[model samples]
Target: MASDLVELDRRAVLTTMATAELVTLDDLSRPTPCAGWTVGDLLAHMAAQHRGFAASARGDGADLAHWHVRPPCPHTPAEYAESADDVLTAFAVPDVLERTFALPEFGPEVTVRGEQAVGFHLVDYVVHGWDLARALGVDYALDPDAADPVLRIAEMVPDGPDRDAPNSPFARALPVDDGSAPLDRILRLLGRSPTWPDRPDR
Candidate 1:
């Protein structure tokens, strides 16, 4: 089951990365459903996140104090695509799931078992990938099997200090219509406005 989940997550990352690669700078500058971040900022942020995750997969410590956003290189979109590939490679490495990793945000110096860490990466990338696609006017879909576990994990994230910190990426709780699907409800609960800008015509 863990392997299957990882495979689904890999597929989601690849699909989202391809969609992101197709976006033009003009499209990236447009307003996104995420309150303050433009599409470009979101792209940059995701690319950095991929790189950071890749580093972590290699047993690099979680002190990203030296991490800095590299300026978009010769072919910026391609670079982002490559970063996604790097993340996939790191995650797919043999025995990677047998290692311990440091996740600072979850704690100052705590260690998580391999499967739990993989699940965390899967949830983060898959959801953030959806955010990028929704913001960039691209079609994005998560494999149902993959999304199911991620939604469960998301639900367990209590709406407390971790989620309500001043600089938290998620917003405070919002009312989710009872009829909303799990994915939409989860997104809304985490501060994404379901009615922002305009719904995608697709």
Candidate 2:
């Protein structure tokens, strides 16, 4: 069970969607760890990301038309769950990992290796799962098996000035304390406060 990133990713995404299903309509309007996104916004973004990534697995990633978030529309929890499943299915296809991903969101020239693209998606769901649980005031406990593999993927994503460019996929890395918990380290590496809602009132 060493470094099974694909399975870890599948577990994270499925659990996150399950957690999201518990979100009441009122909770949809509540804030999440993402700066300007509410729970609803987060769900919408997740759905769009799932579809976009699935398209990428099919080698259509360079099609800008496939990358835009769908316009806001009424949606149910089931739809969100299905979207997560879609990408999982796409990634499961035979030889999918051997294909390159052209990520136009990063830049026209920014293509990602298959395993790296999967790593990127895996880490996103890990953090996003935490964000959804926090937004709903629920506990988010990653699977015990996920820590090592997730950490490996987290460290692979660089921090520092590269993250500060306008429209950069990630916010600048937040400072993390030594010997922090694995999840805490993951959040900070990706610029999210582990204690998001409890951030000192400004």
Candidate 3:
């Protein structure tokens, strides 16, 4: 499961990078599914997350400085790509899955096993990759095998008031039909709409 999670995470991050590369300067101003954040803002957040996860993989995640989001700039895509590389490299270390990951963003004393942390990262990129693709009016896909595990993790995320907290990355969960597609179900569980900018009231 650990190895599978790593491969899926790698694919998700790489897919996100490919989608980001398709963005021209003018596309940066485009609105994203993430409320109030533009494409550029999404890229900045993604890059910061990459750096933070890399630091956590290296047992250096407790420092809040590593997770600070960079301001959007013309070279945001390239910066995001670099951060992606850093994270992939960090996760490549021997016995990394056996180490503890300090995720200070969760709380000052929060820590989790490496495999769990990787699973968390995997779910994040899977969703955020879709966010970027939707923002760019493109498509994003993860490995077919990823749907089950990702969905399980998404289900485990609390659907309560914490979602509305300041700077929370997710919003309140939305209801989905029992027959909804796997990806759509996962998205709704994480407070995202698969249809995105095309809501009926919009």
User: Judged by TM-score, which candidate is best?
Assistant: 3
Residue 166 shift from truth in candidate 2, angstroms: 7.2
Over the stretch 1-202, how does candidate 3's per-residue lDDT look in tens digits? 7778788888888888889889888988999888878888888888888999999998899998899886545547889899999999998887778889989988999999988998998998989999999999897776688999998899899899998886567878889776988898888988888888888311
Identify the runs in model 3 with alpha carbons over 4 angstroms from their true place: 72-75
Q: Cα deviation of 182 in candidate 3 (Å)?
A: 0.9
TM-score ranking from best candidate downward: 3, 2, 1
- TM-score of each candidate? 0.84, 0.89, 0.95
**Root-mean-square deviation per candidate:** 3.4, 2.5, 1.7
Better of 1 and 3 by lDDT: 3
lDDT of 2 at 29: 90
lDDT of each: 0.70, 0.80, 0.86
Q: Which tens-of-lDDT digit does each residue in 1-202 have in candidate 2?
A: 3236667778889889889789878888998887777888888878878888888999888887676767777555666888898999988876666679878877877888777787788888998899889999999997778876677778778888877774344666788775988898888888788888987321
| Clashing residue pairs, backbone N/CA/C < 3 A, model 2 | none
Error of 2 at 107 (Å): 0.8
